[model samples]
Target: MTTLLQIDSSITGPNSVSRTLTTAIVEKLREANPGLRVIHHDLAAAAPAHVTPANFPSAHPISAAAGDAPEFAAGRAASDAILDEFLGADIVVIGAPMYNFSIPSQLKAWIDRILVPGKTFSYGAEGLKGLAAGKRVIIAVTRGNFYGPGQPTASFEHVETYLRSVFAFVGIPNPEVIIAEGVQLGPDARQTALDKALQQTAGLNAA
Candidate 1:
């Protein structure tokens, strides 16, 4: 069976546009692939802690010092589990909403866990190479104001750009993206953007 990882990091619950888009995308994928296994992680409900000196060694096992704190051990275990989920999934769907011109801190924390050096990427004499390459990534992005290409504030757009760069660095270069931007401009713009995003999700290919 194809394993799908569904991640939602919106704090707004039902009012989150990114969450709605991700749900629709997942439903579409399910319709196309039977017996799909889904593993969901709701970052808003159970947010991962930001990386600190205590837990930072989890990614670099050799750098771990002796006599670490109990909390550090627990954080390492949690990060290990998160990395395992990412490695196990054949497809990943993310609901990422823009917060302060970037992705939510909860989502960033989750990212810190998955982007381990030896696990997802590595460096060699040739250059940096990504180990996790085959998995497909689909991102559902929502921003209040317009920040797309050629927009007045496009330079401020970080959600999609950052996600693309991260995923590319980890070996998935061309992630499928569905965006619902300028939702806060007006009711009409919101509906239009939502409808367009839903249509994009409907047109997505199956795993």
Candidate 2:
């Protein structure tokens, strides 16, 4: 059976369009494949601690963080678990909502945990090598304002760009991105954008 890791990072709870679309996308995937093991991780509800200077020590490099230091060991373990989870998943679905022209700090912290040297990637003599390259990722994005090519806020939209760059660095460069824009405009605009995103979700290549 294929394993899917679904991460929801929206702090808006039930009103979050990204979460709504993400759930639908996972359901669609589940329908396409039988007995798919899905893991749901909510970053908003349980955000991981931010990476700090204390954990930057050579002995506390996440994977080897559990030697003897009790205080730093927990952070190291969390980081290791985060990286391991991503490495083990066949597919990843992320509900990423745009907050203040960027992603949530919680989600960013999660990203820090996974982008470990020699774990998810390595700097070889060839410049850089991506060790974890085969996993498929689907990102569900919700934007309060328009951020497409022609939109005024296009340049300010960091949600997609940051995710794309980060994932590419770790190996998966071309991920399938679905967006729900203009969500906070009004009722009609929100519904229209949401419905459009959901349509895209339904037609997604979950195979």
lDDT of each: 0.90, 0.87
lDDT of 1: 0.90
lDDT of 2 by residue, 1-207 (tens): 799999999998998899999999999999889799999999999998888744532333543544556676666666768878898999999999999999999999888878878778888889888778999999998999899998877899999999999999989999999999999999999999999999999999979
Report how far residue 26 has shifted in candidate 2, in Å.
0.6
TM-score, each model?
Answer: 0.95, 0.93
The C-alpha stretches of model 1 lying farther than 4 A from their native spots are: 57-71
Which regions of candidate 2 fall more than 4 Å away from where they truly are? 53-68
lDDT of 2: 0.87
Cα error, residue 126 of model 2, in Å, equals: 1.2
